[model samples]
Target: MAHWDPRGQVAPHVRRQVASLAAAVDELVVVSTADLDDDGAAFLGRHGRLLRRTNYGYDFFSYKTGLEASRPEDFDEVVVCNDTYVPLVGYGEVFEAMAGRPADFWGLTASQRVHPHVQSFFVAFRPWLVGSQAFRGFWGRMSPVSDRASVIAEYEVGLSRTLTDGGFRFASYYTETDADRALAQRRVAWWTLHRLPPPRRRREWEFLKARSKDPWNPAIALADVALAPSPPRPAGARLPYLKIDTLRYDPYGLGAERLLRLAERRRPEELAGVREYLAATAPLSAARPDTDLRPTPVGVRPLRRLVEYGRAA
Candidate 1:
């Protein structure tokens, strides 16, 4: 299952991602937040089912709708993912690896910032989990929410706790480690001091501290580790923070380009639809200018320096 917002016309990149996922799964169901444009509808028609709905509750609602449309007994496993990521490397291999793992539910990554939960971006639930009363109950408890923070708190964080309390087990492709926590903390400091602005920095810093005891942000850390070279290390290994402000800053298309090259070399057929998309959406500039880098505020500078030293060491 994939949740999308056509926005206007669905980008070629999104279509390509959907097509890639379609190739990997037995059935592909797309729940769109808005009606698809003709091109979007036509492209998805070739790949899978596309259902349009009001953009009310965000991905969680779309996820519920998709689950409602499918019967648990009909499929051995079901995956729910959103279109924020492009599978650059072994999309198949990741699933194959998870298939051998014995867990009721699993995702490509996990976060332990506030509470441990499998990041919902690409999670797979076995039929056992899918059919569980707990599973159904979780969705049943959902209320319509358009706020990102509310979704994160009530759904993303709440889901893991709900399921675990119900005696359902979970796992992640990337496990949490002490090293990961240590590195994450350092990165958090770096991001707060160097990346954010004066007015917002303190607030973001406090939020980061409250949500994560560690230094690094989980989402940013996940991207860093997942996109690393072969023999990938755990999240927050050596991967630098990649600012994820959509088009405002990206890593010069390094991750996507790497994936494209890998696809061209090994899965040429899979590269067809994405070629035009990648060409059209290539990053228009180099990395965002770093002229804004500044020292932390007087009260915070010493603490920031301590973290910077720890990261360096």
Candidate 2:
């Protein structure tokens, strides 16, 4: 997976994720957006090929860079992902589910809100799609820009349109169905009531409820449910769905908490790594003026510690 961090170093959770991916795939290459420190370099170097580049393009550019360096001809399939979400559980199950799918490219989940396209957080491209002119031309025509909106509009949204228009079939692990969408809405409501503080809870509930009727992007809510600790379920819910878009909205750091829990349960040895990471990064996150001002929740002690550290700093 192509990885990027604004801090110019990979987080411990990301390192663990890379190790997991390396175990599943035959070849793994990490294209970092910035120069790695000795530790980052050493960690990534041991697992796979590491390509460091100037932080010019976002994940899209990082993907392109990794593709060019690896030469798509050398591999049958290429998976492009970032360090945005923690694959708490079922990392291998996701790939295993997609193994025999007959699609040019596919992602873990598809979104239809902004446009009909697979969310780029975790996408896999087969050789047929990778070798196509549409894929090559998309990157060839790409111009580096630091603007987030431009990247989303031109690359994230536009790339899907380009490939689909070029007759490349698209598929996803989970397609939004009416039943699941309703489940997602209910999940959002339950989370708002149980998770958020009383003062902010009402406002968030009303806003989410209204949006649930005609969600601009249901994937966000779907992800909230899929990654939630104990997701509420109807009578019989069997299918597993996954989406990992961490950058969009995670004001409470619940994403990190879930990831920490996953590590503690499945991979307890990694807890120290995740704890150290949160202790260091959470303070940086809280220090921003735009950060949520609400007090940290009761159970997320690591985040609370970080808040204290930030206050002292």
Candidate 3:
């Protein structure tokens, strides 16, 4: 697993999730921004490997930084996730599914259910699939600079086209919203705008309201169910269906103490600096941020404590 963070401090929830993942897997690596400074460096050094870089914009920057810092050949399999999505199960089921296929790269394309949070915009795949020339061709056609969003757009379009051309079909649930959570909310909003409380006024108002807003709000599209192509493919370039619920767990924690311990063993001074920064930024803590060291308590600290941590160290 590889993690990238722009901030000096990692969120508490993210820390726990990461910890759970590391415990499940054998090799864990982290790539951070050097801008995190000594304290941030110390924390990462203790918990996992740290690779520092400058913060670029979202989309492209986050991906580029992670890609540039990753040693893909180091592990047999790798998983990528953001701070928001936590793993609720282990990799056992996923691994078994991959048994028949090559392990060059695997991406989780299915979810247990429709998530109501962020929309699941793009399908998952091995980075290389979307990183290929076919994808670049798509990107070249879409965006000139190839930043984050554009890359994502190009990846989606290109991957779909490529997979389809290769005889593989892309599948999605017709009834699902973005990440699965929006479906419910969309239905509620749609009903409120159009439904009449009284039988006397069963006018075209509700339908009209839906028509007016549906075009503008993408979530409204979830009301319609779009099923995947029926019948699994028998030959090359086929999309396979894996039951979403088969996943065992999804973690969302990062263990700070374990991380600290790792750092102390690898780089003592760096670990000290990290603890010092955390202390300095901590509310009512002895350490204070000085001219050189500015502790920024990022995770669970209070606002005043965070401000002081930033001011102290």
- Evaluate all candidate structures by whole-model CA lDDT and list the values in order: 0.62, 0.63, 0.36
How do all models score by TM-score?
0.71, 0.70, 0.42
Model 1 scores worst on lDDT over the 10 consecutive residues at 245-254
Model 3 Cα lDDT, one tens digit per residue, 138-241: 33444333354454344433445555464443333222234334443333333333233322343665654454333211212221111123222222222222
Of the two candidates 1 and 2, the one with more favorable lDDT, higher being better, is: 2
lDDT leader:
2
What TM-score, to 2 decimals, does candidate 1 have?
0.71
Worst 10 residues of 2 by lDDT: 304-313
Q: Per-residue lDDT for 30-115 in model 2, tens only?
A: 88875577888888899999888887778888888888887786677888887766554455767777778788898776767567
In candidate 1, which residue pairs get closer than 3 Å at backbone N, Cα or C atoms, i.e. clash? 184-215, 184-216, 185-215, 185-216
For candidate 2, the lDDT comes to 0.63
In model 3, the Cα lDDT at residue 154 comes to 46
lDDT of 3: 0.36
